[model samples]
Target chain A: MMEITEGSHAVAEAVRLCRPQVVSAYPITPQTHIVEALADFVANGKLDAEYITVENELSALSACVGASAAGSRTYSATTSQGLLLMTEVVFNAAGMRLPIVMSIANRAVGAPLSIWNDMQDSISLRDAGWLQFYAEDNQEATDLHFLAYKVAESKEIQLPVFVCFDGFILSHTYEPIDMLLQEQVDQYLPKFDPAEKLDAKDPISFGMYATPEYYLEFRYEMDQAQKRAKDVIAKAGKEFGTMFGRDYSALTVGYLLDDAETVIVAMGSVCGTVKDAIDEMRAAGKKVGLLKIRVFRPFPSEEIAKALSKVKRVAVLDKNISLGAKGGATAIEVRDAMYGSMIPVKGYVLGLGGRDIRKKDIKEIVSLCENGIGDQFYGLRKELI
Target chain B: MTLAVGCRARPGKSRDNKTGSWRVFKPSFDHEKCSKCGMCQTLCPEGCVHEDAEGFFDPDFTYCKGCGICATECPKEAIAMNQEEK
Candidate 1:
């Protein structure tokens, strides 16, 4: 069934169809509605699952971790501080190779406390050994949940997955989405059965320590597992599109980059705004294009290099900052991915701490991509300040 | 770095095998009571304990050097120590 719905509601519907055995979380704004809806499903008997409302985000992840080890599909969602608080468990889940799916409502971390959109919280944990996927709109957000389960539960790639959507942008924005039927989702994602689990009848070791001589090998094995996910992700995504009518580009999805002289690179909700600008600029006969990076970790370096191989200039726009560093974090990675290539890569840091990023601002970015300095910063008004 | 396996010392000048060089001491378990839940195995900083085919657990005394970590961390309390004569 298709319906015009808020992005959060769409996400809730997608999660419901996935049929998680355990849904546990702590309530934080922007991410609260997601868990609240799941709670409703559990309360109303719409979904048969254990709904664990913990005191804090840490325990939320902890409870899910416990449940997952006990051999059940588990889920949780959080924003900013709640995400940060769950950092330990986040790494643990990945290290343990549990196929737990998390929805990170992209928000800024706080000492001053701002409940707004930014990719800082999720971006900071890029090296924590989880596969990361960013959604550009409500449709993508809804679809990524299904893909997340498939990718995470694959026998070759048994790692946790994070499906990130911007806080209050996609979370609060309304859009028309074609919801997948429960049977369709079932066809796409089979029940999760971990190779090893905490079975009392089995009585085996879980998370045993390795000595210095052996610890590095375990970490290396996990790295190898992530690399295997690349192929599994592509196959699963393509199959989902064939069965459920949603073809999510598993790695990097490009738009109109062929023979393009200037390109703007971006992710998340901002990419939708950039695409509108690209269409307008292309109609004016300007050789401008946009590349939306769907997967941020296990970064599709080779795919990205192949996509941007022909481009003469690239302006990477990031919604998060690395703080006192050279450029936007994603831009740095994109540039490195194109390191040996001859493309002139530039970066622009924009929309931090939930700043408004209008289409005009993205157009300005395209202009900068055309005839301005490399590594520019957008959404800054120095004179007004 | 040499692997700890071939380690030996001169007679009478031989180091006490009990505590090795460590000041603190921790107990190791016999293969009898270990259920091999791996609670202590994962939590140990020294990573001294090992498991066998029957799910029994053992700690390497050469590397263990008595941290007491595995003793307290064990969920089943399967380990105890014999203190050296004062």
Candidate 2:
């Protein structure tokens, strides 16, 4: 049944349906509402699970790691600083091959104390050995959790997953979500029976120090599992579509790209605005399209390159910077993907520290692409500079 | 030899890791000088040390990486981190 719910609560409703055994989270803006909703489910007996509220994000994720290793389906939620703090233990969960699902309310990391939405938080941990998924809207965000656990627990891919949704925008916005019924979810995501788990009766150790001789193999094995997950994600999406009505089979979605002359590439809630802009531009016969990336890690380089093969120019937008690096992380990755393809891929930085990227911004960027405008910042106030 | 398909090991009793081979200096307990304080047993980082029937602390070296803290922390100087014969 369809019901109007806040995005965070919608995700909580989805999580409740899946019946996580343990949930540990530390409170931060945007993500606060998510963990709060889960805590309420545990508090009101709506969800039969252990709701653990920890002092900090490190311990919060650490608790999830311990519980997950102990053969329990576990969850944790965090934002920018919280995600940063959880980094050390977070990597352990991946190396230990625990299938813990984390809901990342994508927010800007701060020295200036930002609470607004951006991709920097999770993107910074791109190599932390977790399967990463970005949602264009609340519905996809909610659905990715199910897919996250599915792929995470797959025998081939026993890795943690980060289902990232834009902070504030998708995390707080109310939208109509077809929250899956408990029975339907149970049919899709069966009770987690991890192949490897810690037992007092049959003791085992995980995340042991791999000697130099054995370390590279462990890392290679993890990469192989991620490669396997690319297929597993598609399988899970297909299965999810068959059971539900939404098709998430593609790793990347191209809006108006089949006959597009110019394109703007983006992710997260900004894609929604970009889609609206593409429609407007198409009405004016501008021959513009938007290439929205759903999975940034294990990057869909070939898919992205193929999507824009016919397009003349591409503008890659990033809500986060790579600090002192060349361009945004997505831009660098996209350029790497487009290597040898010879497409004029330009990188544009925007929405850092939660600055809004309206539909007009997308239209202007496409216009800029058509006008042969090269890589530069979009939506920057020159007066402020 | 073929490694496992994934990073996953056999999932129990990794007694074959042969971590004791990593011990450049192995801890050897001297029963004659032992006070039976069980300090070696408590100080062994591997927790592989155990009291024998005579209450002398002896370590099961199979699982021990052997940092030699047991020898270093022994109050009665009853333990020695001796170089391996090899």
Best by TM-score: 2
After superposition, candidate 1 runs with Cα above 4 Å error = B1-61, B64-86
CAPRI tier for the interface of model 2: incorrect
What is candidate 2's lDDT per residue for A1-385, written digit by digit as tens?
Answer: 8989899998888888878999999889989998888898899999899988778999999999889988999998898999999999988888888999999999999889988888999999999999889999989999989999998999888999999999999999999888888888999999999887878787666776665557798889888888888888888999999999887777899888888888888889999898888888888888888888998766888888888888788899999888788678998898888888778888888999899998888877777767777567778899998
Query: What Cα-based lDDT does every candidate model obtain?
Result: 0.83, 0.86
Residue-level lDDT tens digits of model 1 in A18-110: 999999999999998898899999999999999987889999999988888788999988889998999999988888788899999999878
Compute DockQ for each candidate against the true complex: 0.04, 0.14
The residue pairs in collision within model 1 are none
Please give the lDDT score for candidate 2: 0.86
> lDDT per residue, candidate 2, B1-86, as tens digits?
44443344545425446677777787788899999998777777788999889888888877667687887888888888778875
